[model samples]
Target: MDLSSLRFAHRFDQVSGSAIREIFKIIARPGMISFAGGNPSLAALPDEKVSELSVQVLRDHGKQLLQYGATEGYPPFLESLKQYVETAVGFRPDAVLPVTGSTQAMDLLCKALIDPGDTILVENPSFLGNLQCMKLYQANLVPVASDDDGMDPADLEEKIKAYHPKMVYTIPTFQNPSGRTLSLARREKVAALAAEYGVVIAEDDPYRDLRYRGEMLPSIKSFDREGWVVFLGSFSKIISPGLRVGYLAGREEIIRKCTVGKQSTDVHTANLTQAIVDQFIRQNLLPDHIRTICADYGEKLARMLGHLEDLAGLVTFTRPEGGLFVWAELPEGLNALELLKKAIDQGVAYVPGTHFFVDGGHENTLRLNFSNSTDDQIDRGMSVLKTIFREAK
Candidate 1:
């Protein structure tokens, strides 16, 4: 018998994510102008500031940081984080558990709540990573229809009644891939529904502060009267992604459960990173930093949209107020999967929208990221995409 014949866990039975991974590999080639990843602009990362903070924190408490720490979080970070969330995010969480990233926040939520075969309602085109996480937990991921206003409350109610799902996962503000925000009224409705149905709501809102145009809306967690909503936050968008600092905010009991799950996951998020982020919060550096990045990103967004205007009849795309991505749909029968190969060959790349869909049927859709590219890159890449679409037509 061969070692390859050894039995593996059934959790991996439906989790083959190789297609997009292959696309990412192509995007990494030299000279590739990639619109595939939701990465913060290099200019936005505070490398110098992070270095200063790291040295300061290490010099202050080097031993405690290097030694093993509690599963809950670093106390200094916990204090600053709670204040930041309450003031900036508009919710006083019963508890907050810092994690490696918001990605781990989702994983811990699943670990704490989901059991094999439990139903989890999701937006039709949700974030692929979390969708895969749900699949690994063996949860039944049912799709809910969405529009310009985000997940429709009516459809959500119908799905809730039909499936009686254990959880409802949502990226409420400036949602991933789609770049759509849930309306304010619907946010309240979602919270109310969660309480009525006894279902948990995972409100993953990493991009809330990335707004370029629209007014900021209240979080679903803010409207959560009961303890049903859990807010997932990340610093990857506004700060350095390599730092990998994010958090989960929810009721005490729920957070306590996630904290236990996190212990087995990665003992705790790196203490030095947490301390650096702590200094950022304590010094109130985010407002000015966010303002600076938003100015540049807003311009990039406008430039991309202007280029999209030239492709008017050829394509239609979301006009998002903020967030890193722009979702687009090509003319019917034109598959984005096929277009991607030509895109990569021409030194441009985008993620085909089909990968974002739960059931994976829409092939004419794609996602573009403007933040990572310079103005020249956006112009060149969009031109390449335009020529590809026109030739396909």
Candidate 2:
């Protein structure tokens, strides 16, 4: 019998691979100015500091870091991370589990809570990666409507009544692809709604620390009165994506279930990276480091916005207070997917906003990341996009 005749799991039936990864392959050509990924600026990575921290952690805890670690977390990191969450992140976590990245936190949450056909309410144009994660778990993803203030709580409550969803997933601060933040009032309402409806809220907030302007808002989890909210955080944006240190914080029971699920996943996040991040917190290195990165990224964001402003009536884009991406809408009937072919040919690339939608038919929009592009690159890439959209229109 041919092995090619084998049938795969039904969980994959509705799922296709990431569209962004496919775009990455096309833009890999030399001279491509990619606005396609949510990567931290190269200057923000702090290589020498990481090297110094690595050596220090190794000297202090070499044997344990080298040996097998707990599925819960590396010991020092667990302690430091909990303190950091309470003080810096503004929540008192009952339990916390350090995972490979916040990406894994999504996977483990789905594993812990989802069953085939279970409903998960999400923002209409939400983070694609977690949407795919829910699909892989055979979820019924229901789209909740959103405005500039982020997901509307009235719409969310209506969905909760209708769908009786198993979970509600949101990127409440500096949302992915759209760069919108949930308002303080809505944040409080969402937490209240979750408790009232007895639903789980997965507050994935990796980009919270990346804000370049305005006052910092409290997390949705901070307003959570019940055990219904879980906060997922990532060090990838602030430190190095290569380090892959991220965490899940929540009620002990829910966290325990994720911990059980994680045991079969990667077992635990790498000890070396956890220790390095631990030192970052214990030594109080993040405040100054974050300030430095914010300054550089702020300039880049301003440059990209300037280019977008030049587009004027031809297009409309979000003026995000802070975050890596700016969402843009081309004129109706001018398809971003179709325009991307012309853009790649012109040495520019971006993710079509259609892919971010739960039901996938908003062809007029696209997402552009400013953090990964330089002043010159943003100028060149946006010029290419403007030319393509103008000619297409």
Query: Which is the leading candidate under lDDT?
Result: 1
User: Tens digits of per-residue lDDT for model 1 on 15-76?
Assistant: 88999999889888999999999999999999999999999999999999999888899999
Candidate 2: residue pairs that collide: none
Q: Which stretches of candidate 2 lie over 4 Å from their true place?
A: none
Clashes of each: 0, 0
In the range 1-393, model 2's lDDT, one tens digit per residue, is: 999999999999988866778898987788899999898989899999999999998998999999989999998899999999999999899999999989999999999999999999999899988999999999999999998999999999999999999999999988888999999999999999999999999999999998899999999999998889999999999988999999999999999999999999988899999999999999999999999989888889899989889889989988888878999999899899989998998889999999999899999999999998888999888888878888898
Q: Could you estimate the TM-score for every candidate?
A: 0.99, 0.98
